[model samples]
Target: MTDFSGLQQLTSLIRNIEAQMEGAKLMILTHEHREEIARHMVEGLVGPSREHKVRIETSSGEYMNQLAILEIGGNKYTFSKDHQGMFISEINYYTCRITPNSHGILVYHQDYPGVIHDVSRVLAENKINISSMNVSREQKGKSALLVSLTDEEIPQSLLSRLQQLPQVQQVLSLQ
Candidate 1:
């Protein structure tokens, strides 16, 4: 039998992380093999989460069997195992990792010229240094998610300013 223990643990962890960001509404999609077990495990795990009900579905793709997808806060986060037998994947297009010990900002916006310059200018003006940046987009000149790690915490004022930018749709500060 396939083990879902790690998958259960990760599901709980993701809920905890998202709960800190004003709570999360969760949805899970996976293979059909052990529906009752998977549902029971996930339901018990996510009991204390902001949204308790986990919508489980059978995914059709051949490569999607081992994957567990969580839709939280209107974003889809994919988690699965690597061939090495450890669960280590997240949907690449929407999931970006911000390192610990760094003040991180997640920006959802349209991909356009000067957006980076605008955001960088604001941070630079506030003496915030960018330690790292990870950006993912579906296509050029379209929507993108940018995860920026800074040397220092971003203040509310700067966050508000960034949200005011024309291209920026949402800004979230994460520690």
Candidate 2:
């Protein structure tokens, strides 16, 4: 997976949904440790200021999949300045179930009121169990939610429904 195809595969995933997320916070990362390369790409995309939003370039497997663990977004500047390593770990959901390429994270933003509830309900309605969840918001009228789950690809209809929500800005699944 360390071949050039691996890099192109991830890049294509991101580029496919980048424009839908104007003003949405982004946390660009990799399963490969390429700080200089990641930084160059992010700077070109997210801009140089890096104010309210952030981009965290951390190390992970250069070849296979990675745990869904991720640092918060707004603190990237503090992280760059403080120099104190802030490591938060998340347990992979399907530790015993599926292989690496099968698990991934789900990201989306929906109407603040009952968004999380709606997501959980949707998953339950579809028999998708939520093993771990992390939801946060930047300010009034802005939010980000990430759910790392096991096997079973979320169906197109469900994903489209989430994307059609009134206040939902972006919906993307990365594996």
The top-ranked prediction according to lDDT is 1
Give candidate 2 misplaced runs (Cα > 4 Å): 1-105
Give the alpha carbon lDDT tens digit for every residue of 1-175 in model 1.
5555555555554544455423333333444445644553465346535455455555554665345555665555665554444242443456554322347587888999888888888899899999987778778988888878798888988999999998999887764
Residue pairs in steric clash, candidate 1? none
- Model 1: runs farther than 4 Å from truth? 1-68, 79-92, 100-102
- For each candidate, give its TM-score against the true structure: 0.58, 0.43
- In candidate 2 the C-alpha lDDT for residue 43 amounts to 48
The C-alpha lDDT values of all candidates are 0.63, 0.43
